[model samples]
Target: MLLLLPTLIGLVVAASIPPSIPHETLEVIPDGWKLHSTAEDSQTIALQISILHHHTDYLDIAHDVSNPESANYGNYLGAEELEASLPEYQRSAAEVVSWLNNHAISKTTLDGDWLHFETTVGQAKELLGADFMYYQHGSDDPVLRTRKYDIPIHLRDAIDFIYPTTHFMRPKWPAKMHLLPRQHIPTGPVTCATSICPKNLTAKYNITHVPADSNSGSQLGIGGFLEQYPDHKVVQQFLKDYGLRHHDKPYKYKVTLINGGKDPNIPAKSGAEALLDVEYGMAIADSLPVTYFSTGGRPARTPSQPGNKVVPRNESGNEPWIAFLQHILKMKSPPQVLSLSYTDDELDVPLPYARKVCSLCAQLAARGVSVIVASGDGGSAGTTTKDCKGPNGKLRFIPTFPASCPWVTTVGATNDYGVAHYSSGGFSNYFARPKWQDKAVSGYRTLLNGSHMAWYNKTGRAYPDVALAGSGYLTAGGGATYQQKGTSASTPVFAAMVALLNDKRLRAGKPVLGFLNPLLYKNEGMFRDVTEGDTDGCEVGSEVEVGFGASKGWDAASGLGEPDFAKLLKVLT
Candidate 1:
């Protein structure tokens, strides 16, 4: 009876503790999305459950392989090699599968670390102890989701997060640029005074070397999101009008569609953002092979009407960036340099989701792929707006995501004068500063001397890792010429520059510059430092010039100045 009494007490204690814990929760639904009626019990929902993955030191490995001084420099991991390095997940998978089976959900597909399943709303609600509801973003069809969910306490260690939950990140409309008819086409060398052309950029940066045919394997990728599709005819017209030498007569580029994405050549439906991206990238890189990744999901649907027919109806449930990454990461040989000219505010994305995406970027870096992203166009404010106050109603500076992610290279905007006043640059409220950029950012912090201290997080990650000419650029599309400006223009142009450098490295038998931040920080002399201009737009009520300004070295306004192609080529080789 004494031994039995101890056993009985142990059983009672175990039964008293709650079986589940909160996994992902939000106090309220994110803005730009409205809650509709509760989802029907019979309505089906597809969920991607992310099992918590073992953290690998991909950052350390990326830095080691990218540093020029290191003996292991350029020794990047292949697909199988990287797979072998990851921790085995048999135990984690078994536990999650067991929990799902307990809820009568036996049909599930496991892809890498993600478990995919389709279940009715009633069953899903009972499984996760959540209330499912319909959420409509503008005029788009409603989506099924829950404000919060809980998982069994025993399975907490095995699962990282799940989605179709609290994450509401969707594609917004691209930046608006006023289109103007062309007055005249340049028959000779383009001048830098009127507007920026491929010729002007090549001359300004001293980019004389064209990619050789032998280095065609070195490709550049331009990420296209929402419904933006580039037209080949526009690109051809741009090359001819600008009088820039190109590899192909028709100006060809490969199209890779992901998640039911489309690549149509319809002139009327051509997108300005897509045209701007491909026009400059193809012109600058010249003969280098370029691939346009048209990723579907997060359609550009407004309250008035649906976006163009560039995406599938079923794709509305997925996130564009996630869909893009899922496709790109599977390839054995992706492009050496990939550029994305899209950005969202850091606070708008959930912390867990952001970390997960950033880790994938780190993996790409380890595989010798350089990812470049635009640093937004909101100056020191937020994404495409000039508000000084933050989401919490506090007067603070806002930073953009992916730019603040630390793994990818973030590019800011500059003009013929100096740094563009609307070039977005600030410290992140989410990620801490990486050690690689400590010296460069510290110099700027010292120059700042504690000014605007309360407006930002001092210990957070700082960005606009590099800068480029952003304004007064000419782009052609849909049989019309237009003038465009923003960090989006600068991103593709800089990516094209990197693509050329990749070609040189391949010809020289050296590896492509995988993660460029480590190398760029070490050799500040490769860039032409801009000691003038300020990122000014954060004026609230009576405050004037209430944002970050450029300094002698690295500043938030123009990061390490614009790239000098000749100097970069010499140092890189």
Candidate 2:
């Protein structure tokens, strides 16, 4: 009966996982638990605290919903400033963090808040310190619906432990990130992909994908996101021209088609995102050089009458999504890095689904898989283009999804100077910090002014621990590789780097640097901090703004800064 425990644990872990994320074997649960407190109280229930809960977007920047720019920006806005910006309930987040640190809580190690998991139920009056606003969980239990603390939580287990297997942008010493012209297309010929790759010289290594963009038709591209952006048509053509095809290449590449938002069982209107993802899959696949593996079914789309045929179901927060992707990649073994350009905004105390996915991402990282993600195109305000015909016909400035998932390496976009504009940033509505941001400062400089805080009240690190090129001149495929912009474009670039690192790691036989947070934060030399500038506008429009300045350390806009590909390559290699 005791030996059967491992099997039971695996089954529970698998059943609890979100559909899109992967599930690994379970680690042993510790024999005992510790009791910690924030030492504060309020009307709302505050069980646990964290910034950008899960995914690491910058924390909320507003003091009130009425003011988008009200809250202070630099360095968590300082203690005095934070005190003024938040209500009593919100300010408790700082106290929670302060108490944990004061008590010497091991942030990323298995000893304390790290690698911790729990499920509790009670009223806001029963949990941590405050009675946070009653956020609905679509659950029947009054506790979950009103003030129940059915919190399914986990934390970094080591003072410098990795997020199991998640990651994205972490620069190297002498970090200096830059971009080049449209280099290759999704289906072009294969011939020395590394040749003339920009940001490759004067340091380590650099990586990227082939047939950069996807498309097969002239009128519309495969993916909804690509077609939505300008210059997509040109990118389609570039993929046709430069990218090497599997037939044209000597090396082999595998593919996995993910319709994470699929929901035929639901209405199209209900699953519109799934519909959009269908096209997204085809578009992405068409632009690539390898064959996309599938579950023997076409990409799922939300049916109408209820189906937003153009969109699919919203599975942006599923764990099996990433897990399945990894399972499909099956590179004889897991790669050192995996890049995913997905995100979500609803993570603070993740929905049942969010918890499952977070666990999967964490497990993968523990086994050594670097997950890179896109912060978003909304800039610091987080713009969301929702299908508003039913409730919101117009797009709103809401946080994006997936990118908000804490376990994956959340990435934001940046311009040359390293400041940010509209590139999305803020705290999570669902998850919490998973260790990794902890690092000692080197003799380097950056834009941000203070150390990152781990808490939930007020605002927390919503996203963008690191940044990359997503500006004026980058390439993609409409049918071939061409140039375009947006955090979308930026996402793949980082993914490619992770891939390159994987290529190197697999050759070395080292644990593929599983769960990269600790290493990333501890290794400040891998990145070049961007302490100036900010984005303005959407990817299609210019609204966010960034000043042209270069400083040291994290900045309000650019966070820890951008990548220095040269340094990045050296470190990874």
Top lDDT prediction, candidate number = 1
lDDT of 1 by residue, 321-435 (tens): 7778767777888998999989887777888888888988887887888999999888888673456656556778888888898889999988877888888898989899988
lDDT of each: 0.79, 0.36
| Candidate no. 1 TM-score | 0.90
Model 1 score (lDDT): 0.79
- Candidate 1: the clashing residue pairs are 52-160
Candidate 2 Cα RMSD after full superposition onto the native fold (Å) = 18.7
Which runs in model 2 stand beyond 4 Å of their true positions?
A: 1-253, 257-336, 347-350, 385-400, 438-462, 473-482, 535-551
Task: State every prediction's TM-score relative to the real structure.
Answer: 0.90, 0.46
RMSD of 1: 4.7
What is the alpha-carbon lDDT for the whole of candidate 2?
0.36
| Candidate 2 vs. true structure, TM-score | 0.46
Residues 1-573, candidate 2: write the lDDT tens digits. 999999999999778642321211112211111111121222211122222233221123311211213332111222233334322332333433443443334342121122321212222223222222212112211111222221213222111111211111111111112434444443443421433113321122233323333221111111112112223234234334332233242222333344332212222122122222222222333333322222111112222212123322232112234335434223333433555444434422124445545554554443345566667665533443322111122222334456666666667777655554647665554555433442322212122333222211123334566776655422333222223345554554555554444444445553244344444665567787676664442222443222212346643345466666556657755
